[model samples]
Target: MPGFSFETAERTHVGCVRKLNEDRVLSRPEVGLWAVADGMGGHQAGDLASSMIVDALSSIELLGTGYAFLDEVQESVQRVNRTLVSHARLSRPGTVIGSTLVALLIYDGHFACLWAGDSRVYLLRDGRLNQITRDHSMVQELIDSGALQRADAPYYGRSNVITRAVGVNDRLALDIASGPIQEGDVFLLCSDGLTGMMDDDEIEAVLKARTADDAADHLLKVTLDRGAKDNVSLVLVHVEPSVDDTLRTARRTLLA
Candidate 1:
């Protein structure tokens, strides 16, 4: 498989209502990797936890034939979880630190995603938006169990309560999946900050704009304008069909 470079940009904001931003994001353009994380614990613990996850994942390299992308990601996440748990115990007693992680890993004309909690990844192609990640929250669980209607998810109580998150439990349940990519395709990795404030339609409209940087900035701005109740983070990536030899070699070595 050949290697490709991703053109990307990211932006995060405290928003109109939040006193401090707890969202964190990281991107590796050479590897075509990106991630968005939203912290759950109160105080600055959430911010620290989210940053640790990004830092851990950003260093991981996924490459080669039959490479273990999912395993590597899970390991990195676990390390971050441990770090968060240790920090919580030492610095902030009784402060449970956890976060939702949504990431994109581009490889060989396709991409794999690892998602947990309520953060999401959306695909934009041909002027349309399709949500690619499912939320792991109480509302989604009810929908799965036939206890709640899908259409009523927006207004459902406990909608913000996430079912799965890093550092929340000893073992985490993550939703992992893969899909094909196309030229001119745009991918969005965002926290609940944007999705909770703006619907899918609004996000698609802003993403279909001129460039990745513009899209990411606009998304954050729009969320804040709409009364961002929490810290907002967004990462926009445009994948093209071109390949880079250096990137391919690095990924190959990582796998080896």
Candidate 2:
């Protein structure tokens, strides 16, 4: 945030099979906060869960430090978890209201990704793509344990069964990964809707478009072309030096 700025490209759509889109996306470049949430439940209950999360996050204030920002975000999400859990308890038996959460936080030249369930965050640095968040799903576990092959995960029958999510359990556990952000680094936050339609290689190629906006649009269009079976949502964030920083670099080069 000090000498860097962010540009975001985002979209959310109801896929071919779904009538109502259960996915929600938040792109707050000014606050350096962005997220993608995919809700899971029948009869539009998914919408409620995803919307509640994005609404809660949409109002966060970046306080003292980067660490405080992280804490506030985690607390806000946990609060929503409690609220949803209570709501489900008050409803009929076997009523499940839950959603996956993947949030990208940037502050003072640093970045952090907080998530639960199968949604993902990826970083493309120096033209090389790497997935930042590991999925919390049955298929992922099987792949990790060597019971299933990485190439076969997309076709895994139990792919939809996630191990963690808000509203699914009273104690919502979010995993956090953090590091310093670099200029030209691009961060992608998306629901499984996109990943389900393409492998990492395919996604990496698409993200290599001339601009972040182009890459984001192309990603969505490609998913729809593949017969997106679930609600699709994604946010592509491009990092760059601020105007002042760029000027400073130019000045130094001229002086040299």
Candidate 3:
């Protein structure tokens, strides 16, 4: 990934029903970091929680790559977690302000996905679409436990319940997954607002678009068309070899 470059597109929509769009997206390809955070709707100051996450991640300065970069990201998220928890303690007894975080980090030739709650990171490679980050929602737990069928997940009554989040607990337990990055691989980071409106197949069809901008526009359009009931947000990143890297690859091929 060091020799490659990325093209990214991001979109946030309030949807048709929500009065406020409590979703935040960060796209910093320069730093090889991108994220999406969905504020828990109906909770106190959901928008504020999401914005704080974006601001925290924006402050990250890449001192090094790999685990060092990951450490910086994790610490920033944890710092925000502490802030939100302290603020809630000073507020009313039932006040809870939190947001789900899903961040994609690329460095060297590897990629890392860090997440808490249901925000997702997906990968599209070799014409196959794969969900890289697993959801921490009640519906997903039910499916995993065999208490609910995967097909019934959409209709599950407690679909909004999330087990892990950035600020709900004093010690935030973030989940991480890492793998090598492949040229031509495409990554998608999104809030549940987008997923709640569209299915994986519908998303795959949209991702098939030729450009990141087109894919983002078309995806948001479809969400609105389907009567989006929650705030929707997404960031699409396309990986391509840099010109110098491409020439080097070509030279290697010729030599071979």
Candidate 4:
């Protein structure tokens, strides 16, 4: 398995309506870890919960390659979940402090997507964009059960309600998906704040037209323009073949 290099960019905004931003974005390209956490529970608690998630992730040290690296990422997220639960019990009692998490980990030509709640991970490859994670929200459940149409989701009063999130329970159940890495692969990890305001097609269009940093900026601007009712956060990652690998291939070709 060959290692790759990543180009990453991230942004988080308080939004027009919210007085406080409870969303947190993590961009640790050196360690191949990136995530977006959207907090829920009110100003102080929500901000605390989201910050706890990113802080725990930022502390993760790469122990080994491949699966070992992925293990560390998962463990770190779970560790934070427990810490948040404990904190709520001891300090906030009866009030839930939780955050939705969506993370991307790439190592040794493999990529893993882990998430809970509505925050999402999207991949753009060969000019097509695909969503990698499903939302664990009330509206999603309704749509899955054929009780509600996807078009009407935004109009539902409880559309913002999530069914699963870190720190909301004693144990966190994250959905993990993995696949082989591809050069020119672009990944977008974002809080529901961005998705809630813009549909998948609109997001895909912006990502297709700009570089990682520009896409992130454009997405935030569009969200704000469209009435960003919630805090918006996003991380954009672009994977490419390592310079050493490319050089080696060129040298081999010249000799042959």
Give the alpha-carbon lDDT of every model. Answer: 0.82, 0.92, 0.90, 0.90
Q: What CA RMSD would candidate 1 show? A: 6.2
Mark the regions of model 1 whose C-alpha exceeds 4 Å error after superposition.
1-4, 86-94, 243-256
lDDT of 2 at 249: 81
**Global local distance difference test of model 2:** 0.92
For candidate 4, lDDT tens digit of each residue in 40-134? Answer: 89849989988998998998887677788878878888888898888888875588899999999988788899999999999999989999999
Using TM-score, give the best candidate's number: 2
Q: TM-score for every candidate vs. truth?
A: 0.86, 0.96, 0.94, 0.94
Report the lDDT tens digits of candidate 1 across residue range 49-162: 788888888888755632476678778898787777776677656778888899888766788888889999999998899989999989988999999998888898677898
Best candidate, lDDT-wise? Answer: 2
User: Candidate 2: where are CA atoms >4 Å away?
Assistant: 250-256
Flag clash pairs in model 4. Answer: none
Compare candidates 1 and 3 on lDDT and give the better one.
Answer: 3
Clashes of 4: 0
lDDT of 3 by residue, 140-159 (tens): 88899899999988888888
Q: Can you write out model 2's per-residue Cα lDDT over 141-249, one digit (the tens) per residue?
A: 9999999999888778878899999898988889999999998999999999999998888888887765889988889999999999999999999998898988988
Worst 10 residues of 2 by lDDT: 203-212
Task: List candidate 3 stretches off by more than 4 Å.
Answer: 41-44, 247-256
In model 3, how large is the Cα lDDT of residue 202? Answer: 83
Error of 2 at 227 (Å): 0.8
